[model samples]
Target: MKIAIVVKEHIETKGGLERYAVTLSRGLTARGHEVHVYANRWDVDESLIFHYVPCVKWLNLLKVITFPANARKHLAKSSFDLVYSLTPLYPVDIYRVGEGIHADVLRARFPNPLKRFLKRLTPKHRSILAIEKRLFTKGNYRAIITNSKLVKERLNQVYDVPFQDIEVIYNGYDDKLFNTNTRAYRGNLRDTYGIGDKEKVLLFASNDFKRKGLVYLLEAIAFLNRRDIRVRLMVVGKGKTAQYKRIAERLGILSQVIFAGAVTDIERY
Candidate 1:
C-alpha cells in the first residue's frame, strides 16, 4: 500500500516521539510499501523523507502554510491508502502520534486570549490536541497508537476515551547501542573527570534539564551525601547547564559532581 507519513520536525526528539516515527517509517519501507515522508529537513537519515520541506525554523514560518499545503497536495495526488501522521497535523486518515506534554501545561497556564492566539499561529500542535480530544468522542480511526501507556492512560482520563480505541505501544531501545560492552563507555567518562571507580556515578541526560528533573536529582544527591552515600554525579547534555551547575555548587557537591556537556554519543558518557 502507498503511504504518506507527516511530522513537524525531523530532528531526534528528546521524547519518545522521534523513535516512534523513525521505527515505523523504517518498518514500512522494509515491508516494501511505497512510503513518502513529509517532514522537516533537520531530521537525520536521508531515506525517511521522500519529499523535503523546511520545518520548525524561523524562515519556514514566512511561508506558514506551505508544509501542510504541499503535504495535502502530495497526499491528494498520491491517493495514499493510508496517511499516518506522526503528529496531529492537517487533515489526515489517521493521527497515530498522541499529544505533547504542553497540552496539560497550556490548560493550566495560558489564559483564553493567549491560548487562542497560539491556536491561530500554530494550528498544527493545537490540531493534534483537538484530534486527541476527538478520539474520546469518535472512534473513526483505523488505529491510534500511543508511545506509552502513560499517554494512553492520559487520554482515557482527559477525554473519557476507552482503552480499546487507544493502543499502547511502549518505546523501544536500540539494544546494540545501550548494551554493557563498553566500560570504556562509562570508564573514559569517569576517567576524563578524575572520578574514582569507588565513586558512585549518576547519569542525567536531557536537552531540557529542568523538565527531566535535574535540580531535584542534585538535591537528592546532596541529601544522599549528607547521609554519607558518597555519589559522584555526572550530568550529560546541554540546556540549563549553568543553572544545574550553580545548584550543585550551592549544595556543596561541585567537587563531587561532573558536568559533561552534550555528548552526541551518549553511550560513551
Candidate 2:
C-alpha cells in the first residue's frame, strides 16, 4: 500500500512525536510500501524523499489555520491507501502517534503556566486542536498507532473514540549506540567537555526545561547538596537556556550547573 506521513521538526532529536513519524515511515517502507513524508519546508531528509509543506511557522498563526490549504490540496492530489500523521500539532488520518497523554506524567513533568493553560482551554485555545480532534475521531482510518497505553486510553476518553482504533507502538533507543562497548565514545564526549570522573553527574535531557521541571530538579539538587552530595548538572537541550542559567546563578549553584546546549551523539547522553 502507498502511504503518506505528515510530520514537522520539534527538535534536532528527542521529540517523541517527530521520532514516531520517521520511525513509522521507515518501518512501512521496509514492508514495501511506497512512503512519502509531508513536512515543513525547513525539514530535510533526502534519503526519504520528504515533500516540503507550503505552510511553515514564520508566516504567522493565521497561516497555521489557513495555510494547510496546501496540505489539503496535496492530499487530494495523492491516491495513497494510507496516511499516517505524526502530530506536529496538526490533524491527519489513518495512523497517528499521540503523545504525553498521561495526566500524572503531565502533572509531574509539565506544570508550567502555558501548558496548564493549553490543557485547560484545549480546543478552545486554538482552532487547530479542535480540527485535530474532529479529524482523529471522525476519520476513516484502518488503524491508529499510539506511543503509550496511557496516551491511547486518553485519546479514547478525550474524543469518545473507539478504544480499538489505537495500536501501541513504542519509540526505540539505539541499543547499538547505548551498549557497554560505547565507553570509548562516552569517554571522548566527556573529554571534549572536560567533565571530571569524580563530579556527580546529573544528566538532564529535554528540548524545553520549564516544561520538563528543570527548576524543580535544580531545587531538589540544591537540597541534596546540603547533605554533601556535590552534584554537577549537564543540561542537554534547546530552549530557555538563559532563563535556566539565571535561575542557577540566583540559587548560587551556577558553578554546578553546565548548560551543554544541544549535542549530537547517543554516547553524550
Candidate 3:
C-alpha cells in the first residue's frame, strides 16, 4: 500500500507525537508498504521518503496555520492509497488524533467556563478548534485513531462521535530499549547526578512540565518529609523549571529534586 503520512514537523523530533510518526513510518515500511512522510522539516533518514511542505515561519502561529494548508495542497497533486493525517485536517482517509481534542485540552487547562470561552476566541485556539470540529463532525474521514481510551471517550463526549468510528490505538514503547535490565545503568546515572544509592529516585519525563503536574509531585515529596526513607525526584524534559524550583524551595525539598533537562536516551531513566 502507498501511504502519505502528514505531520507539521520533523518525525525524528523529541516530542512524543513526532517520535510516534517516525516509528509508524518505519513499521509500515518494514511490512513492505510504501510510506511517505510529509513535513516542513525532517531529519534525513535513508530508510524513509520525505516530502517537504513549504510554509511561512515568521511567526509560530503562521507555521501552524500554513503547514496544513500547504501540505494538503501538495498531497492533492500526488496519488496514494490512503492519506493518513497526524494533524487535525480534512480530506484525509485516516486521522490519528494524538494530541486529543482542542476542546478537551482547553477544558482541562482552563477550569473556568468563561476563560475557556475566551481562549476559544484566540487565533491559535480558534484555528485548532475549527479544524478539530471539522475533522470529527464534517470531514469525510474514514476512521479516527486515538492514542488512548480517554481520548476516544473525549471525542464521544465533545463531538458525539460514534464508538464504531473511533479506534483506540495506544502508543507502543521499544522493549529492547526500555526494560528492567536498565537497572545496571541506574547506579552510574545516579552517581553522575550526585544521587546517593540510598535515596529513592522518582523519574518524571515530559516536555510540558506544568501540564505534567511537576508542582504536585514536589508537594507530594514535601508531605513525605516525615517518612524515614529518603526520596529524590529526577525531572528530565524541556520546560521552564524556575517556578517549580521555587516551589520545591518553599516546600523544603530543593536539595531532593534534580532537574536534568532533556536527556536523549530515555532508557537511562
Q: Which candidate would rank higher by TM-score, 2 or 3? A: 3
Tens digits of per-residue lDDT for model 1, 1-269: 88888875545544446556677787888898877777755456655546665534454343445565566666666677888887544466676654444465455334477765676457655554554455336644566677777777776777665788778766677777767775657667667799887877887876566556677888998899889888888777777777777898999998877878766576676
Q: Candidates sorted by lDDT, descending order?
A: 3, 1, 2
Candidate 1 residues lying further than 4 Å off, grouped into runs, are 12-16, 42-49, 59-74, 93-101, 105-141
User: Best-fitting candidate, measured by TM-score?
Assistant: 3
- Evaluated at residue 153, the lDDT of candidate 1 is 76
C-alpha-based local distance difference test score of model 3: 0.84
Once model 2 is optimally superposed onto the true structure by TM-score, how far is the C-alpha of residue 126 displaced, in angstroms? 2.0
Model 1: lDDT equals: 0.67
C-alpha RMSD of each candidate structure in angstroms: 4.6, 3.7, 1.8
The sequence of per-residue lDDT tens digits that candidate 2 reaches over residues 82-191 is: 66666433345565655453344446655686786666464423555555565565544556777788777777877666887778877676575567776666666667
TM-score for candidate 2 = 0.80
TM-score of each: 0.75, 0.80, 0.93
Residue 138 of model 2: what lDDT?
A: 54
Indicate the worst ten consecutive residues by lDDT in candidate 3.
7-16
